[model samples]
Target: MSHEFTVEAGLVIFSYDGRAQFGWLDLKTGAYHAESDGRCIPDAIGAIEFHSDVTH
Candidate 1:
């Protein structure tokens, strides 16, 4: 998928109509609908951490 989305002043738009899928709207006057890959790790959790290739 082409995640070629761009934003002016670092702003983004996202929405969900409770239909089926979620999507991202770019600032280029275009709408990009993304699909669920349906592949997820069981028991996934969220956290606040920093990771990098060089430093943490």
Candidate 2:
């Protein structure tokens, strides 16, 4: 099973899989950066909630 959720922050969208895997994608440039790749997640990205039906 897999779990995922998305958060919209201004021009970018943050995507996270329930397993310490997350990244932000720039809407304009289409750039993506993962937390494990040395990219910093902004403070604006606060708590995240995974819906009960968020598994596939």
Candidate 3:
């Protein structure tokens, strides 16, 4: 089984799967980012936020 959802934030759409995977597409640049091993969107969002904060 699989679970998925999509959220639009500004020019980007965040796509998430319940089975620890997700992807995001940037409407403007047509760029995207994807990864696995996330339990949920919030979990992955938190990790991305953390990574972004720490990296920059």
Best by TM-score: 2
lDDT of each: 0.30, 0.43, 0.34
Candidate 1, residues 1-56, lDDT tens digits: the string is 45543432221223333233333333384434342443322222221222223311
Over 1-56, each residue of candidate 3 has an lDDT whose tens digit, in order, gives 16543433322224445332344544485444453431223423311221121211
Question: How many backbone clashes does every candidate have?
Answer: 0, 0, 0
TM-scores of the models, in the given order?
0.22, 0.26, 0.23
Candidate 3 stretches greater than 4 Å from native: 1-21, 35-56
Superposition error at 18 for model 3 (Å): 19
What lDDT, from 0 to 1, does candidate 1 have? 0.30
Q: Tell me how candidate 2 scores on lDDT.
A: 0.43
Q: Which candidate number has the best lDDT?
A: 2
lDDT tens string, model 2, 22-44? 45555585455453574654433
State the lDDT at 4 in candidate 1. Answer: 44
Q: For candidate 2, which ten residues in a row score worst on lDDT? A: 47-56
Clashing pairs in 2: none
Per-residue lDDT of 32 in model 1? 41
Worst 10 residues of 3 by lDDT: 47-56
